[model samples]
Target: MKKPHLIVPEGMEFIRDDIGYAPAVLAGNTLYISGQIGRDDQRQLVVDKEAQFVMVFENMKRVLEAAGGSFENLVEMTSFHTDMRDLPLFMQVRDRYLQGVYVAWTAIGAASLCGAPGYFLEVKGIAQLN
Candidate 1:
């Protein structure tokens, strides 16, 4: 069997150096992605909730694409949110990204995140090779 490739995107060093985790992991046919924050491709956090949701999903997509996978292949997801009020807005945002794809999802409340003013939410997921 061919070993699954380990992929780190060209500009991902910012994630490792400052974000504090590997962006994605490919072990055999499964991909385990680290939690993605509301940061741009440049790694700057966007404070707007709806906009941040889009930004965070974009980050997640980049990692998934690097692993040769996509959202439709995802089986599970967990979201951590500092404010519960944002949950409904998050659902609206999530629907935009997850159209036609159903993922087993968990949403949790958190007191804080690693960054100041904190993120509206953080998202993580697992994907199977298709």
Candidate 2:
């Protein structure tokens, strides 16, 4: 049998989206994390899109940690948003966390996310393990 290339720790999701895909996938020294939405572990859509944006980003951080990686290891990021007008706010909040270790980023205007009204953003990331 082929063993998993990376070991995701307990409490981290073992995502196998039957109808779609997972939050992340690790192969070799590279991790391809799927876009993260603004939902808690219970799948509740956060009340505010921007707040949820931050939350989802934080969630992504946790997922990275569980997989033995750090935010600094991220090489790229992509954000999908329902409203492009909220870019400044998103940038403000996103800037609060990441410093000079800025990764390549792309933001797109989206129609709707996977859930409720306030849940308007999703973030996906790619990281290379050290």
Could you estimate the TM-score for every candidate?
0.88, 0.85
Instruction: Give the number of the best model, judged by TM-score.
Output: 1
Q: Give one digit per residue, the lDDT tens place, for model 1 in 40-84.
A: 767788977789988888878888888888888889999999998
Score candidate 1 by lDDT. 0.83
User: Over the stretch 40-101, how does candidate 2's per-residue lDDT look in tens digits?
Assistant: 77767778767787888777887788778888889999999899998898888788767666
* Model 1: residues with Cα > 4 Å off, grouped in runs: 1-5, 15-20
After superposition, candidate 2 runs with Cα above 4 Å error: 1-17
- Each model's lDDT: 0.83, 0.77
> Model 2 RMSD to the real structure?
2.6
TM-score of candidate 1 to 2 decimals: 0.88
Best prediction by lDDT: 1
Q: What is the lDDT of residue 35 in candidate 2?
A: 79
lDDT of 1 at 48: 70
Q: Assess candidate 2 and give its lDDT.
A: 0.77
